[model samples]
Target: MQKIKIKGQDYQLPIYLPDATLGVARNLDSLDLLQVGLEGVMVNTYHLIQKPGEEILQKVGGIKKLMNWSGFVSSDSGGFQLFSLIQKNPELGKITDEGIVLYTGPKKQKKTLFTPEDSIRMQFALGSDVMICLDDFSPPKANEKRIRESVERTIAWAKRAKVEFEKQLQKHGFTDDNRPLLLAPIQGHNSHKWREFCSQELQKIGFDIYGLGGWPLDEQGKFDYSFCQKNAELTPKDSLRFALGVGTPENIVKLFFMGYQFFDCVLPTRDARHQRLYVFKVDPKNLNQEILKKLTEENRLQEIFDYTYIGKGKFATDNSAISQFCDCTLCKKTDDIAQVSKAYLHHLFKIEDGSAFRLASLHNLRTYTLLIEALRRA
Candidate 1:
């Protein structure tokens, strides 16, 4: 699965998709995304349906036409967002066997039923290249009884989602080879027994891809690599694994080795807007799959990746580009008079200019794409 053809477009695998949750990446356009070597993006079905609404997207011929983006697009089923909302305040919604019941209006009286079938239908309307099925997320601190309930509900929802996916495929006239890929997440938190059960059942039901669902963090909020490693092993050797909402550069490197091929995260773009910039610690030219593989094998990730706080006072006087290895718009500026140097970028942020967000985002995204390029070559 080194290369994938989606919506008649070809893209390399082990790819990274920035969160363009609402058809647009913040402060950047479609061309801006393409220029930085982004092959695709992960959009949120929950947000798009609220803002522009479904009718407009269908009328405009989907999100691609509305944004004029020809790149690959993956749509999330909004399970996690709904889960987060409900977890924070129980009054907002509740996850039922039938569907998700969202409470709205001034007093939270209005109710809307969002089922797994509805998720697939909305994804069809969005014209997504990859569609994720809605799954009940296993809470991190759940006991056995709660974890079991989540696993049961997740499988039930996936069964319903599969039925709807087939219906949408026939209705939309998509054939086997040309149809969008469907992915189902494996739930049950960190419980190996339930997680393995969830994996086997989902495999029996079948899906084009399997997702690493649930929070991949510990009580201390650090990444739990053992949990991720076990999840990948639970799936079949040939399955295309998608690590949803995962993570920094080192996390990506480690997971890629564990057999995951797809990833979507808000870190790079979100970090960019927050003035955190990723930079290769070593010479970019020396970087290759073999080199990266060796580093991971030896657990030398810190030697391979690092980031700089561009908002720091020291960078305000630095004359260098954000990253010498970067070929982004801000990094590759040739003319001396208009060079997008660290000093210039610092000034933009200091002045609170809008361009600062776009410029910083370009550099960070290019950093991720560069890493993806190295991984694909292996």
Candidate 2:
């Protein structure tokens, strides 16, 4: 699909949504996001419900109003966060067919059940354009039996989520053409048989989009491109696919070719805060399908995408801008004000200045958006 229509608004596909886990994208605000050319953001349902609570969101008329944002927002089912918590501490919670059972409070004795229905209700309250169904996350080291259980539970929860989604649409007076899009993730780890089963079952239940669930990593802990390709094949050619928590620029380019059009990852912002900056080796103004195809065919995508560790001591005296092609606040120079150079950014980081985070984030976000612009043109 070249584009997706949400609530009657048209947005181009192969879009990258930065993670705004708890109603914010770390250092950047909504205006900063728009300034960096981002059209959408992803939020975590579980986190928002716990912090801001549902009542506050309803009072404020949803997250968009609360954040003063006027762009598309996608809410994740929050299954991944819960899964990680429970995995790290078994006493925290447990996943069942009904939903996730949590042990909260000081003694871990307080019982709270987060069901698939609840996830949908929360996303509706948040007024997300795209909402994901809660699914059992497959841990990296999951075995055959664990994989089977995850797939089974994922399908069961998806059925419940779909029911809840329809109820909300009617209650909110949203029609088929203007309703929010629901997405269900397929989970089965790396097992082809189980992955196929998960995909088929989710397809039967139906959703506007299909997500590539579980960790996209191989035994060596490297990105598993073959697995992503297989998952994309599991869905129809025309069906929209979301690469949840998907990755670096190179990964996005490869997955876009494999038919995955939607992406969300914390990499850009997270890396920015850690002093890692992404830059294009060559100007992307000359990008096209032919060039992209040739680069992929020759496995030369790595050449175009480069990185800079800005916190390094070597950059303290470097007067160069982060990226010559970047048009972010830090990179743009005016007659009176000078562009933020590597030397200044390095000094800011060394002094632990808060502006360092915001400036770096702006630059990094712009880099990602520029890549998206190129992909859209191609």
Candidate 3:
């Protein structure tokens, strides 16, 4: 019932798990760093079930109160994990007409079964703002028989998740004022025909949002962007289209132009932890001869940075201590990339410093939030 509007656009933010360890706590902390651009945080159902257990989270006032975050939150059903788990240990889990049965953890110690109804119940317990339906996924090279089986099961699961979510909402007296939205995922491998079939079928099932175009892109050593675009075209325009698990900056730009409204991935945060940052130039000439000279002296002058540097190896004009391009707090506050230097970050990896993780997480989050803002303006 609590209607959460992101960026004043009547849609939810698509930021996925901050990371594995901290969960919602990390997301809440990043909000300060993200400022007003922060909208929603996404959590993984499979990961949460393994670690904290949904019961514990419910006892702690659900994810939002536990993290003390008021914005929208979404949870992915454990479908993808089941698929990936099958790859690792084919015998680790079994799929039946009803649902999936799997073991959790390194020891393969605990056995748990997740039906579509069960997946919905778990999200309800977590009090997610959006609950995703369970869907079967197959990699690009999946056999025709396996792909057909998975797609059929995925459709069945979507029906179950939707029915259960509606029943639970009614039982709990959920209204537009405080009810969460439900999303259905479309699953099909590389085939355009199957992709269209899945999309058309799921659209009739009726969900507030839809997730499209997932599965291992690297198996073929290149992405099938055309397949993705075709699938996107098949989806209904009234509902939001989310491109799950793919959020490279360039890919995001391309997908946005292709009509995707929501995206989530670990690239920005993961890359920042490895000392990669995204920079954009307001004035091309601000990155002048002097800044290039300093960067050359430091051996940090890459062709990529040539478009953005202002001086002293700093990025973004606001961070230059002399110009003003970005208004982000990190750039406005100080010229201290040392506060989050590549050298210190690399040192952290070399020696495994916990502080480095925190810094990298912070900077990466900032980069993602800023990028989303920029995209919206454009």
Candidate 4:
């Protein structure tokens, strides 16, 4: 897919959406995101509902208005977060065919049910351009029976979500040409049998986008490109595919060629906060799809990605910019003016200053966006 049209706006495909999970991209504001070339962000419905609540969001005119951003916004169903909570602490909630039932209180007895309809309603209130359907997240180390159960629940919930999505389109006066796009995730852990089954069933029901659900990892805990490739093949060539929560720069490049056009990941921003910065070993401006494809064919794409640890002792006295090639505020080279110095970043992190976080985040986000720019050209 070259581009995806949602709510009358067209976003260039093979794009990377930074995880602005709570309406903000951590230390960076909307302006900062724009400066880094990010045209879209992914927010979590569960957290926003809990914090600002849906009523406040509606009154404030959704997240875009709340954040003063005009870029594309996609809202995750928050099923992943709920699943994570229950998996970490079974007392928090339980997932059933009806929906997720939460028990939150001092003694874990306060009941609250979150259904597919509830997810759809919340997305509408949030005014998300792209809304995700609530799916049963495949837990780690799940057996065949557990995987099959997750797939079944995912399919059932998707059917409910589709019905509710239609209800929302009508309630919000969204016409067929202006309606928000809804995506359904296919879940089956790593089982091809159930993955195929889930995909076929969801295709019959239909959706604007299909997400590669569950973890994209193998038994040995390595990135499973084979699984992602297989999932891409399960869908039609013209269909839009979202590789949810995926992954490193290399992962993005590989998956893009595999026909996955949309991706959301926390690696760049999250890694930046931890003082880890991504740098292109080769200047990205000098590269394009043909070069990248050649590199991939030669198994040399890994050479393009490198890292700089600002917190390392060696960087304490290094006066060079974080990256010589980056155009972010932290590393832009204009004549002889250096935007930011490695030594200064080291000092800021050493002193635990807040500016260190913002500067580092800007640089990392720019790196991801630069990679996306190259992918777009490809």
Best by lDDT: 2
lDDT at residue 312 of model 1 (Cα atoms)? 90
Candidate 2 collision pairs: none
Query: In candidate 3, what are the lDDT values of residues 160-195, reduced to their tens digit?
Result: 889999999998788766678888777778766777
Candidate 2 residue lDDT tens string, 1-378: 387789999999889999999999998899999999999999999999998999999999999999999999999999999999999999999988889999999999999999999999999999999999999998889999999999999999999999999999999999989999999999999999999999999999889999999999999999999999999999999999999999999998899889999999999999999999999898876775568768987999998999999989899898778888778888887763439999999999999999999999999889988888888885
Q: What TM-score, computed on C-alpha atoms, does each candidate reach?
A: 0.97, 0.98, 0.79, 0.98
lDDT of 1: 0.91
Supply candidate 2's per-residue lDDT for 282: 87
Model 2 global lDDT (CA atoms, 0 to 1): 0.93
Better by lDDT, candidate 4 or 1: 4
Q: Over the full model, what C-alpha lDDT does candidate 4 score relative to the true structure?
A: 0.91
Off by over 4 Å in 3: 1-36, 104-111, 216-219, 281-351
TM-score of 4: 0.98
Q: Per-residue lDDT for 1-378 in model 1, tens only?
A: 377776567878898999999988888899999998998999999889997999998999999998899888999999999999999999999999999999999999999999999999999999999999999999999999999999999999999999999999999999887899999999999899999999999999999999999999988879999999999999889889999999899999999999998999999889988889999876655677888889999999798788988899997888888877777788775764336888888889889999989998988999998888888765
